[model samples]
Target: MEVYLVRHTETVCEKGICYGQSDVPIAAPYLEIFESIKKQLPQDAIVYSSPLVRCSQLASYLSNTIIKDDRLMEMNFGNWEMKNWDAISPDEFTPWMNDFVNVSVPNGESFVELYNRVNDFLENDFQHNTSKAVVIVAHAGVIRSILCKISGLPLKDAFNNKVGFGAVIKIVL
Candidate 1:
């Protein structure tokens, strides 16, 4: 199976803000980026997207028959959503920064929890459709989770993958 993992384009949020799973809008002038991303994917690929507007908009542009899945959503930042990184209390943030894979946010999930969600989607929804190419439009975290799963990278080292905004990565499974 050919999987095209695409991160949504930049969001309207300013830098330093954490908007995980917040349904933030994409930045302006995104049509051109979407077009470019579309061209890199298989034309007949099955399209899947996170329910967030950022991913949904790009997925809709790529294909009419889009399947929105909650599992594809970004990591849940809980109380940290929409807050500046510096604004979060260091006591709370430091622990997560030190061990994000195991430490769950105040009301959000841990990296390992997010990894499990992505794994469930791949095991239940994706693996069954291995005959056709798949285009997954999602957030950077979701894309990274998929990449980590396929590459067998440790969850703690997931950030090493460097999934840039609007980047499209193809992998054979």
Candidate 2:
């Protein structure tokens, strides 16, 4: 099976905001980016998207044959949702970063938790499908989890990887 991990288009958040799982909408004029990405997809491929509006809006462009799955949603930042990163002091974020593999944000999920959810989806999909290309339109964190699972990378290094908006990454298994 081949998996195409596609990040959603740019969002309205300013550079420092932590908008994970906030259901924020994509920025305006994303149609051109969406069009360019749409051209890269397999014509007969099955598309899946996170339930978030940013992902949903882009996925809707190819709604005729796409499925929305909550499993693909980004990791919840809990109380940090919608807050500027600068507002959260290093004291708060540093500890979590130091032990992020198992630590959860206040009222939010840990990286391990996100891994389980994404793994469940991948396991189920791989078991039930064969010989077809699959495209998942989701967030940066979700894509990072998939890469971590496949590449056996440490959770801390997830941030080091860049999953730009509208970027496409293909994984084969």
Candidate 3:
């Protein structure tokens, strides 16, 4: 099976802000970027996207039929959503930074939780249809989790996979 993982274009949030699962809008002038991304994908492939507006906007532009999945959403930052990273007290942020894979945010999920849900989506929703190509429009975390699962990379090292905004990666499963 061929899978195309596409990260949404840049969001309106500033660099220091944590907008995880906040339903932020994409930056302006995204049509051109969407066009570029579309050129790299198969128009006939089944398309799935995060329910977030950022991913949904791009996915809709690429395909008329888009399946929105919550599993494709980014990590839920809970209380940290929309807050500047620096503003999060070191006391709370340091622990998560030290072991994000295992540490959950105040009211949010740990990276492992996100990975588990993403894995479930793959096993239950994706794996059954292996004959056709799949296009997944999602967040960086979701894309990284899929990459880690396919490559047998440890979840802790998922950051090593640099998923830039609007980046499209193709993988054969």
Q: For each candidate, give its TM-score against the true structure.
A: 0.97, 0.93, 0.98
- How well is each residue in 21-117 modelled by candidate 2, as lDDT tens digits? 9988889988889889988877677789998999988888855767888999999899999999878878779988788868998899899899899
Alpha-carbon runs more than 4 Å astray in model 1: none
- Please rank every candidate by lDDT, starting with the best: 3, 1, 2
**Positional deviation of residue 163's Cα in model 2 after best superposition, in angstroms:** 1.0
**lDDT tens readout by residue for model 3, 43-144:** 798999999999999999999999999999999998899999999999989999999999999999999999999999998887455566899999999999
* Backbone clashes counted, model 1: 0
Which number leads on lDDT?
3
Which is better, 2 or 3, measured by lDDT? 3
The parts of candidate 2 lying over 4 Å away from their true place are 125-128
Candidate 1 residue pairs in clash (backbone atoms < 3 Å): none
lDDT of 1 at 156: 93
The whole-model lDDT of each prediction reads 0.92, 0.86, 0.95
Per-residue error at 53 for model 3, in Å?
0.3
